[model samples]
Target: MENLTATNLYSFYGKSPVLQGVSFDLKPGEFLSVLGRNGVGKTTLLKSIMGLTDRCEGDLKFGETDLLKCSTPQRSLKGIAYIPQGREIIPRFTVRENILMGTFARPDGKRDIPDYLFDMFPILREFISRRGGDLSGGQQQQLAIARALAMDPKILILDEPTEGIQPNIVKQIEDAIIQLNRERGLGVILVEQNVPFARAASDRFLVLDKGRVVLNGTSAELTDSVVEEHLTF
Candidate 1:
């Protein structure tokens, strides 16, 4: 696993800057959560890291390679697997096909889905032949994660993995995330609204407001008062 660093990062959507002087780091195998209310550039932060924004400036380095100069596919090849909000899996594709898509980002050019992927989410194995759109929201979320994992990423970047998932399955998703971090040694950058889950799963946390980081510290310091002040809507 490698480290990710973003210094004085600014991302723009057309003429407007959505991320202003954002700076943070994700050390090897560490889990960092991005926290904020609606429209505070939380999602934008993830997109900026992935090279999906209209324009970006400042240093974003994954290990020794500079990310700002890399294209979107180049960045993905460098081991950052991004699962954006809304679990954008191909509706017409079978579960197997969807998972296979992740391998396109591999620099090795290998196309096989790793066995660890099915091990992480057995339901994906059970429904290997099913169409992606036929699954429930929770299942789709799992498929989204599984697809990202199929890339064999060094760091998994998730945007609200539990959003709209059934309550019964929320814990399962949470546990899978922690397992990927602790057992498999994958670094994670999570953008989530659930205060309890973020506080529970993260090593450190950052709170963004109107495109700037306002609060950042160890997860132990992300107290209820901090949530009430910066995260609660």
Candidate 2:
């Protein structure tokens, strides 16, 4: 497994800076959570890592590979899978087809959907022929995650996997994410508004404000007082 490192990173969109001097690291197989209020650049930080930002400056490395020059597809091929907010699955594609789309990032040129994906989200298997748009919000999120896993990523970056989903499905998604990290040993970077889950699941946590990292530390250090000060609105 490879480690992800960012140093003094700056991300911009059309000359407007969104992430200013943001820096952090995700050790191989580690789980990191990002917490911030609305529009504080949590999503921008992830986009910068995937090369989706309009511009970026400073060093970003995955293991020994410099990521600054890698295109989004190149980064995906290198085993970085991003599940952005909104669970953007191809609405017209069937559940199986949406999962297969992730195979395009595989360096081996194989297109088989992993059996484990269906195992992780059984609802997906039950609705294998259903179009993505026809699924409920929670099911669509599951499909999005299944699609990401089909890439066989070394690291998974997710923006609010449980956001705006049904209450019961939220636990399922959270459990799946934890299982992927703890049992499957996938490195994970999560942006979450659920402070309790973030505190419980993360090996480390970062608190952002105004597009900058105002606080970061090991999970144990993310005390309730810290949450109140940095995370509570």
Candidate 3:
């Protein structure tokens, strides 16, 4: 467990600027939530850190390594795992196959799925041969997260994890995230719109407005009035 740092980060899409001088630090074994309304560059920030965006200017570092020049796959090998929005699973692949995909970045040659991954998601064991496209939305989300965990990442970036999901499954995912942070010492950057869930899961929070970080503080420092003013529309 360490920290991921983004200093003076700026990103663009063609001529349009999306993230403007966005900066933050994710601590070791800490859960940090990025909360913002639609089109506020929340997803852009995640992509920038993952090396998937067109970086205009920035310095990104994971632990002691500079990540600004690393490729997406290189970043993954450096211990960064991204669970993008929409669960992005390969529909035709089986549960086991999807999990195995995460091992592609491993330095070792083995392609085996760790036993602990199955322990964390026992349902995966039952559906090892089932195709990912056949699962429910919640089940797919679980699979997505489990797949990322299989990478043995030091830091996990999840975008809108609870989106379009049931309350029960949301709780399950939340519990799993907390366990990962507590037991495995995994650092997490969670970008979410569910205010209540984000507040409950995150130790610290950052709010983006118009592609800039407008507010930031610990979860306890955020008041209901502030949440209503900045987050509610």
**Best model number under lDDT:** 2
Residue pairs with colliding backbones in model 3 are none
Q: What is the lDDT of residue 199 in candidate 3?
A: 80
| All candidates: TM-score | 0.98, 0.98, 0.95
The CA-based lDDT of model 2 is what? 0.94
Question: What digit string (tens of lDDT, one per residue) describes model 3 on residues 60-157?
Answer: 88888888878889999988899999999999999999999988877665687888777877888999999999988988999999889888888889
**TM-score preference between candidates 2 and 3, better one:** 2
C-alpha local distance difference test of each model: 0.93, 0.94, 0.87
Question: What ranking emerges by TM-score with the best candidate at the front?
Answer: 2, 1, 3
Q: Which portions of model 2 show Cα errors greater than 4 Å?
A: none
Please identify model 1 stretches exceeding 4 Å from their true place. Answer: none
The digit string of per-residue lDDT tens for model 2 on 76-189 reads: 999999999999999999999999999999999899999988888999999999999999999999999999999889999999999999999999999999999999999999
